[model samples]
Target: MTKDPKVVSFERTPAYLHHRAMLNRRENNTIDALELMRHAVERSPENREYRLDLAELLYEMGCHEQSNKLLLDLLAEDDGPSECYYGLALNQLGMSDVSGAMKSLKLYQKRDPNGPLLGEVARLAAELTLYESMNRPVSRRLYRATRIADRACEAMREDMPEKACRLFEKTLELASEQYEMRALYAMSLCMVGKVGEAKRNADLAAKGFPPSVRALCVCAQVYGILGEDELAFEMIRRIEDEHPYETERRLFIYTLGEMGLDERAADCARLALQETPYDRELLHVRAIAMKRAGADDRAVAGF
Candidate 1:
């Protein structure tokens, strides 16, 4: 039989508050969670994980500098966990401080060669290595902006939009007029459930690159998510009129799938399959659509 959860006792221990903070976070009460996290830190000033939890919460709330300070202070202690360096690396990356980010990542790798996060750190380090190709000097601000934007892309693809959006915010501060980056940042905002902000940012992107097929497709997706299906389908019609390439057409199909218009998604999938008959992504999407529509495994497999 399942046992009852432990009851909170009268003694208000730091660990108890920390446990409550985690529970609040799970319930989506971030404000309360943050307050409780702060209380936990105060009560257990010397506890590494308590302080780390507070710093992580601050990071999620976009307080990068403070988060970095806390993480760095933790690292300065003799018994610092190797994970503190990884947290510092994330903060540095969010701030567009690639040098600092790499330094921390390298330190983390050195300290924990076979650590659980080594694979992820190695991937980021490999991407950082690409910056070495700038044989000639590049503009510092622009270079940092691009590096941060690239890191944001990697973060989002890894399903960590909280980190990606924070980095993109820094990227835009440096290169506010980067149209493509703005569009990508809007997508990241969407991933983070900032729908109204996403629409505004996506609109900014569309205004910059009005006639680009890719921009319009993303605009349609944003509109679709904002409950303006008519506008989205209108954008869809515009893309169809433009007769974009097979690869570009995937964007529209993707929006259709996301909008729950599975029939239209399947139709577009079939049309795309006519060109690249064995395209794995399209095939998988087709199979998924079929499965969502109540198809049996055999029928889905046949797709």
Candidate 2:
């Protein structure tokens, strides 16, 4: 029997697999997406877009070194996209190569002055410049505190709130002015049933000058967990008044969900999705929010 033309075309073309991989990623099926993306890359070895997508997925999965190597290989090609420099900079930052990241950012700006990522590139460049300008002792202390805070964040993600609390305490001792970390510390405290201490830290973080989005979100989460709905809503209002980045917007959505404002969270997620329709993380957040709000149809469609 002869094979069907559609089946032959689907089997032979990498674009179908690539498109499917993107859809799976949007649904937060990262493992399946990774496998599908890998197959697509294998089938179309010379396709730079496929390889770059694979590298970005690897970075999202925390395989920083692998992503960096792939990005480096892409840059070695004379006709590589200027976007590779931005990706390289991200991977370098992930690996703690601040100097290298700065260099890559400069190259990216030089090559693509009108790129879509101009805002992100400028923000990252300013942050890197601030870090580099710090004196050696201050820089070292901040780096140490950041490393401890990273471990604390990992502990929180792993559901070890007590461990995260201890790590955050150590981090605060080294960098006392990091109100964002203090807010996160408050969240860990709340997670472990230390409501009084959590409230204290949250209040202090909320009082910090020029409140940051993450600090506000963490404080809101702590207040919500402590049954202080008024304070929590105020924090959410403050976040809304600010022009937060995508990650911060995600945090705001999560804080709303944590406070049982599922419908509001879904609305915010939908607004964010309108800006970056293909963002897998935002899609995942929106799906969860819609599900919680009893919008089964929309939630199912998202997934």
Candidate 3:
């Protein structure tokens, strides 16, 4: 018997794959979406839209360098869409290349003054201008330092703690006052068995009044790693006192989980869930935290 047309096997063309990728992305299946998007791009190497879409997915996935390269290649095309410049600017920002981002933004504005992303472009431009004016002479050095720190963060995320440590050290050499970077450097140091140095950096980061949520979280992790429970708890307390935003709250919860404070993580996640009822990520985090804390029934309900 013949299968229904809808159930028949169709040729997986580039367009089909691209559409499927977008659907997967909408469903939050990012890994599968990326794979499908890659296949689409590979099959349609000459298709600018496919390439642009792939680059955008890469950018969203934190593959900044890869996305930037693709965007740059698109920008080199005489007939490329002006959107390439806007995407390039975003990737540049992700890489902490403030100057490069500014240049790309200018190009984008010149090419498409009435683009759909004009408002976003203008907002980013205004923010960058304010950032540069605030720091003035030291802005350039800070930007360079931030670029190194971004590399360090990528290394950490890739599980290359030693490389991250080296890059963070270089970042600190240029901008020692970057408490967040220092905190991350401390975490990297601890990962690489440099407990003493980690403690020193973490202590320094914690010294900043009203420490950033990232700094507090990293310092807490470093202290926990060093068996300094008191200090770790102190950092956690500070995080609670700061009235952190949603992103910071997520970080705080994850930090608690990292320090093996599952009950606290669960509690924090529950509190955050009350604030953001529809956040799938918060629900997932809360489920995991609850599971780890042995609240099996609540965990099951959460899932």
Q: TM-score of every model?
A: 0.47, 0.60, 0.59
Index of the highest-TM-score prediction: 2
Lowest-lDDT window of 10 residues in candidate 1? 129-138
Worst 10 residues of 3 by lDDT: 275-284
Of models 1 and 2, which has the larger lDDT? 2
The order by descending TM-score is 2, 3, 1
Scored by lDDT, model 3 comes in at 0.87
Q: Is 2 or 3 the stronger prediction by TM-score?
A: 2
Model 2 accuracy (lDDT, Cα): 0.87
Compared with the true structure, all predictions reach lDDT values of 0.81, 0.87, 0.87
Off by over 4 Å in 3: 1-138, 296-299
Give per-residue CA lDDT, model 3, range 1-303, as digits (tens): 976677666799999999999999899888899899999999999899889988988788766667878888987888778988889888788667888899999998998999998999999999999987886546789889989998999999999999999999999999999899999999999999998999999999999766698899889988998999999999999998997766678789889899988888888878877855544566778788788888868445946
- What would the per-residue lDDT of candidate 2 be over residues 241-260, giving only the tens digit for each residue? 99676668878888888888
RMSD of each: 15.7, 9.2, 8.1
Task: State which candidate, 1 or 3, has the greater lDDT.
Answer: 3
| Residue-level error in angstroms, candidate 1, position 21 | 62
Superposition TM-score, candidate 1 onto the true structure = 0.47
